[model samples]
Target: ENEVVASMSANVFKVQVAVGDKVIAGQSLIVLEAMKMEIPIESPRDAEVAEILTQKGATVSTGDVLVRLK
Candidate 1:
């Protein structure tokens, strides 16, 4: 299992993957807006998305778990 985490404090701008979705390494899973910049949180490895812990427009802090994969 793998957990994709937020790298910085930001608002979730978009969620690009859903539960059970297949994802590859480097695929964008979520978009976050912080300090007027958009950051794409990507998959670290190929896997099926198991859960999404955040929602669009939600505020998240650094190291927050965003997605879980299996």
Candidate 2:
């Protein structure tokens, strides 16, 4: 299983992918907000989204797993 994790502490601004969605490398999966900036979290490789571990408006910390991929 592969997982997408948060790189910094922030609030989840948007979830761009849904479960079962096929994604390509560099595809934006989630957008996080911190210090008034929008940071996009992208897929590191091509895969199908297996699960979304975080939701929009949720708060996450650095290294928190946001999505699981297969």
Candidate 3:
């Protein structure tokens, strides 16, 4: 299992995937907006989403725990 941390290139705006969803490597799990740009947070490997630690429109900072994968 691995913890998916949200590293914002800008600012966190929304979370897409939820716990129990099977995700492929490089899949977008969260969406972030900052500086008029949208940034996507992606899965690093094939795994099930174990936990969703943030909600839509929630602000998250760099290195914040966003999801857990198992």
Candidate number of the best TM-score: 2
lDDT of 3 by residue, 1-70 (tens): 3987866644667777878999999999988888888888899999999889888777777788889999
Better of 1 and 3 by lDDT: 1
- Model 2: residue 45 alpha-carbon error in angstroms: 0.4
Q: Candidate 3 deviates by what RMSD? A: 1.7
Q: Per-residue lDDT for 1-70 in model 1, tens only?
A: 4999999999999999999999999999999999899999999999999999999999999999999999
**Residue 57 of model 1, lDDT score:** 93
Write out the backbone clash pairs for model 3. Answer: none
lDDT of 2 by residue, 1-51 (tens): 499999999999999999999999999999999999999999999999999
Give the least accurate 10-residue stretch of model 2, judged by summed lDDT.
1-10
Order candidates by lDDT, high to low: 2, 1, 3
RMSD of 2: 0.9
**How accurate locally is residue 70 in candidate 1, as Cα lDDT from 0 to 100?**
97
